[model samples]
Target: MEHVRDSFARQKAMTLIGASLASLEAGASEIRLPYRADLTQQKGFVHGGIIGMIADSACGYAAYSLMPASASLVTVEYKINILAPARGSLVARGKVLKSGRTLTVARAEVYADDGTHVASMQQTLMMLPDTPDTPE
Candidate 1:
């Protein structure tokens, strides 16, 4: 839990978006973001890129939470589908669909505060090999 929290604290984009971890568990995680005008597109709705960012991090963190203490994780691939206009506060929840030694697959869903599904994501993450000089 400490590692997960610390890792998230280091994300500059997350900090800029005012996102925070809503929950963290062995193979699941949730991120929350309050609506901010700066995050919106010309349509006055939250931008799709912001939706993807939170969804990507949510899935990445879910995989990271399950990785060994000495390991770090990186997103290798992810696909997101934007379903509806994102309004108000948002929450993205990620769950690991599969875990392997070198690869992990996860799914995530972004929802508006009132529980409207705004976007969905499927992600693949790779475990990074540590170099002798590097630390997790």
Candidate 2:
């Protein structure tokens, strides 16, 4: 759990929420991201793409924390569903559905701070072997 705390604390984007999601571990995370002007659409709601990115990042990190230190993972596929328009602030909750040697499956839910479920996503990640370091 110390590694999870330290790792998220050092993460730039995830740290935007301060401690909201910083204490997240293997089970679930409640992440927050304020809606800045850059994150809004013409209708003054958070953009779909931004929501997708948040969901993807949450799931990826959740999977990464469960892997061995020498392994890494990348998204193989993702499916997102926009449930409602997102406004003001956003909160994404991520959970690991399954973790295996070569693959991980996760789900995330994006909600407006007002408690509206804005989107949901499921992501599949492909675990990769760590690259060996060579003497320079």
Candidate maximizing lDDT = 1
Candidate 2 segments whose C-alpha is farther than 4 A from its true place: 1-21, 131-136
Off by over 4 Å in 1: 131-136
What is the Cα-based lDDT of residue 19 in candidate 1? Answer: 97
Which clashing pairs does model 1 show?
Answer: none
Q: How many clashing residue pairs, candidate 2?
A: 0
- TM-scores for the candidates: 0.94, 0.81
Name the TM-score of candidate 1. 0.94
Tens digit of lDDT per residue, candidate 1, span 94-133?
9999999899999999999998999999999998856211
Per-candidate clash tally = 0, 0
Clashes of 1: 0
